[model samples]
Target: MSAVYSVKEIYIYPIKSLAGISCQQAFAEEMGFENDRRWMLIDAENQFITQREHRILSQFYPQISDGKISITFQEQKHEFSAYEHLDNPVQVNVWDDKSEVVEVNESTSKWFSEQLGFECKLVKIIKPGDRKHESSRLKEIFNVSLADGYPYLMIGSQSLDSLNEKLADKITILRFRPNIVISTEVPHEEDDFTTFKIGDVQFKNVKPCGRCIMVNNDPENGKLKKEPLKTLSKYRVVNNSVLFGTNIVSLNSGIINVGDEIIF
Candidate 1:
């Protein structure tokens, strides 16, 4: 399918590793939203647990209110105030192969366990005092992010609807771990959007997003299904990445809205 040249929609997930809220306007930095995905969940060993491995995480919807974060799932919900400064935090590993993280407190840990019915802890990464983004490919681009990988992952709305239509069951769009959601007038046009502008910001396409089991999780219900992933595996495979959305590098930073017009 060919793309139509127009903007349709935009969205952002405030908290990482949980269900996201649709946004009309969001501030964009080089990596993504200023605080989006800035904090994460780590296991006992401080290893990062994500939707890719833990599908149940998709069930929780997270929202930020008055400097606090509230998470809701099933019939249970909880709101916790953000710590101004965590005390006695231990250094932990976010991944087995990459990323070390600083742990939060046990009070934060109990809050998450109550919500998810599991023993887990919450932690925030202290922003690196001295870190730099030296992309071997895009040397001129400034990369400053707390994301597990890459600065931003943008997905087209039509691309998701197209995928869900193929499945016999209705699937929510949250399965794919995207940082930005854009609606383009052209059907399936985001696949070829090399350069596009949202508000005053412009983005350069870096590569096609690679997909994984994360796409199969039901964000609202936290259930694992096999049909969609099975279907996508048959056709969407590209190199090593599953090839769903397009990975983009920021050209200009600005605010993007849900109804904002995208210029291609």
Candidate 2:
């Protein structure tokens, strides 16, 4: 029998660059999955901070419960109201995109400052109009959350399995930090998928995600590694950039769950 392709895992990073929480199901939104990358950390200059610069960010763990989100770093834990709306708007930068975001609160910022050992503030995306994903291929612009670029990112399980086979040290899929993981026999098959569906929702596969130095930062040990990126560069290089998961944009909003069949 041909290998069955289905949604195996779902994840959401409520705060950009921090740890993600796995879920059995996720609500698809126009910008991204509900609560995915809705929050982010910015320095004193309002520039975004990520694992790319501070590997310790991988050590921060966030958990959602009882209408509140709690983030823990070492022995310190801070909780925030799940849907709290702070009206303090501030200009922030994410990559090349600059937009106005709502400053979460002083206490949240202080908590992060203590953890990262530097001055930083936590902010949330309150207005979708503040940011848009400019696409040369797509006729219409797409709204995005605080994610690097695209709204959704997907990787086939076999893709990681294939990469791990070539490395002396095996790495887990969490290193990839994808929102959606699909089970497939053929590695990198998602690269060819232009349009597909999960359950009843349609998605347009826009482009292959370019692997960055952030992937080198191991999520568990919070240390840099050279296996996967080193191996991927040897064979997966395209246009002088190493490529991995495929970025997707939702064409419709709906509920997607694990075990949902992926229709190409």
Candidate 3:
């Protein structure tokens, strides 16, 4: 019998370095979702901070609805009403590059401060510039327009299952935090897919996704597990970075749905 492949899951992390939401369908863009990761929290010095340093952010819940983004933490909720205007400004560094972005303002900042028990501000990435993927295999400079890294991270459902089969304890797949999860034609076949298309959009494979300690942290309870990480370290090492999935830059913009057949 021939094998079958399809898209099995879709997820979007509305806030950078926070918990993500599982969706049945999502609009794909060159820079990721329409508004995903557009807003991030930066320190007083305008430096970017992520789960790599502050795991407390894993407890924050963020959602998008009706042109507004609402973030909830502890017992309080703060909503941002400005999606059209990019006026409130602050300087923030995505990595080493600093870009001026609109801060979410006092009302939103207060909620985060109380939740994380720290002084921090919400900033949005709106400035369009040349963002590139550093690959020795490429002959020309590969570029993108949004925040750091590629637009999407794709994983195979079977791939995770294969990994879990080797583990002593079963863990939820959300720990990986992938944007697209597809059921490839064969087991681990996604590892060979260079370019895939769904609807009218084509995505070019960029690089292997590097795993981190965040994968061990539960997105819901803000807790970490050691067994899974220890298991991955044995087989998932790549270029000194622990890799789990493939990062892709979109070749076109379109809506993608769960169960969509991806043509390679």
Task: Give the TM-scores of the predictions, in the order they appear.
Answer: 0.81, 0.96, 0.89
lDDT of model 1 at residue 86?
67
Candidate 1, 127-242: lDDT as tens digits: 53212344444565344454545567877777778777788886655677676776655435566767878779898877676677767777767777785788777778776556
Model 1, clash count? Answer: 4
Q: Per-residue lDDT for 209 in model 3?
A: 73
User: How far does residue 78 in candidate 3 sit from its true spot (Å)?
Assistant: 1.3
Best by TM-score: 2
Instruction: Name the best candidate (by lDDT).
Output: 2
Clash pairs detected, candidate 3: none
Cα lDDT computed for each candidate against the true fold: 0.65, 0.89, 0.73
206-235: candidate 3 lDDT, tens digit per residue: 777777787888776777768567888888
- lDDT minimum window of 10 residues, candidate 2: 131-140
Residue pair clashes in candidate 1: 4-186, 48-94, 210-242, 211-242
Can you give the lDDT of residue 256 in candidate 3?
86
